[model samples]
Target: MFTSRGPTLRELAVQALSSVERGYDLLAPKFDLTPFRTPDRILDETAEALRPLGPFRDGLDVCCGTGAGGRVLRALCRERAVGVDFSAGMLHEARRAHPGAVLVRADARALPFRPVFDLAVSFGAFGHFLPRERPGLFAQVHSALLPGGVFAFPVGAPPHFGTLPYWAMLGFDTVMRVRNRVWRPGFVMYYRTFPLVEVLAELRRTGFDVELTPLEGLGRRPDGTPRCAVVVARRRA
Candidate 1:
């Protein structure tokens, strides 16, 4: 469900056909109108869940598309908030939205910042990174954070096996697989690749002490497990 200002079907088709960077560039202007932008509700809840962990110093937002996560950083961090992404267009929009924030254009796998930030938050961008790239990506985030720095992001539970949501995710990933196989400059996004157990282990391997806290505002599953959770990974001190 996108607003009228969102990308048209033709525009979305063109974006899907282009490389990830170029596609984001094309979509940057209308990105906030689409469902792709991280919702404010999730951002606020993430900030609330992280409130007790603060007060933090400089904050960094990894892959901060249009700077939605900057608000969370500003709320928690005492000093400045910085946002980084690979797309120039997204950075441009972010600058317009958050003029005071430091917006950097850099690949997430190789961040330019030192161990300066005490807190970091990323939202809804993990799907862009393939499973094999997770280690390097986590390492990059680890390197950018100060010792004992926090890296927090929300992850949803996988849908029930026979549910429509499950089938939809499966179909989407299958189509993406086929598309990448046949198309040039394939867009990398998979819904089912980032399992919680594997992700927690990867964070540990990256030298982060990982913790999961349920975002109670989003409600729970039938089994009483959280429908979504915040993975709070602290870089080893």
Candidate 2:
């Protein structure tokens, strides 16, 4: 699912063997060419979904790789937009792509910001965090926002059992687990780790009033459920 401009298999192998930060540093220049980057359609659909709930003044993008989420923030927020990521290389790319955005290098679990943001969004970065790390990650996002602020992210509906996509994801996660077990610096990306029910519970426990809205533009499943939904978590005012 990578383009001609994407990293080579050898390059990807080198990345997989390194730490997450180092891997992203190596992959940063070509990240957007890969399928791993958040697609424009998803970003547009997310902005559309968030439009009604906002008139948001300031926006923050948690784990904003190459500023895709920052672009969304710029669209939704009337005032300033900032992006925070742990990878310096990724932040360099983000700054190049989005010169107007204020980009900071910091870990998601210990975000270095006050409760000043009116809205926060993240894109395609959750897989890097383990299930146990999610609560702290959510708490960091919550603390980075104003009391009435919202944290938003898109989550895909799980694929049907035995389907190609399901098997692909399963195989990917399995390979990652095996790699982590064998390797020194484990790259912690697992596709199947973030279940919706568990995620909603964590958000609630972290003091967010959670809700989900179907992204209609992404289409539906055979059973008529949304293929993807945006999870909107609002900190209690």
Task: Report the Cα RMSD per candidate.
Answer: 0.8, 0.8
Q: What is the TM-score of each candidate against the true structure?
A: 0.98, 0.98
**Which ranges in model 2 have alpha carbons more than 4 Å from their true place?**
none
- lDDT on C-alpha atoms for all candidate structures: 0.93, 0.93
Tens-place lDDT digits, model 1, residues 141-209: 999899999999999888999899999999999999999999999998888888989999999999999
How high is the lDDT of residue 212 in model 2? 99
Expressed as tens digits, the lDDT of each residue in 98-179 for candidate 2 is 7767988999999989999989999989999999999999999999999989999999999999999999999999999999
- Global local distance difference test of model 2: 0.93
Residue pair clashes in candidate 1: none
> In candidate 2, what residue range of length 10 has the lowest lDDT sum?
94-103
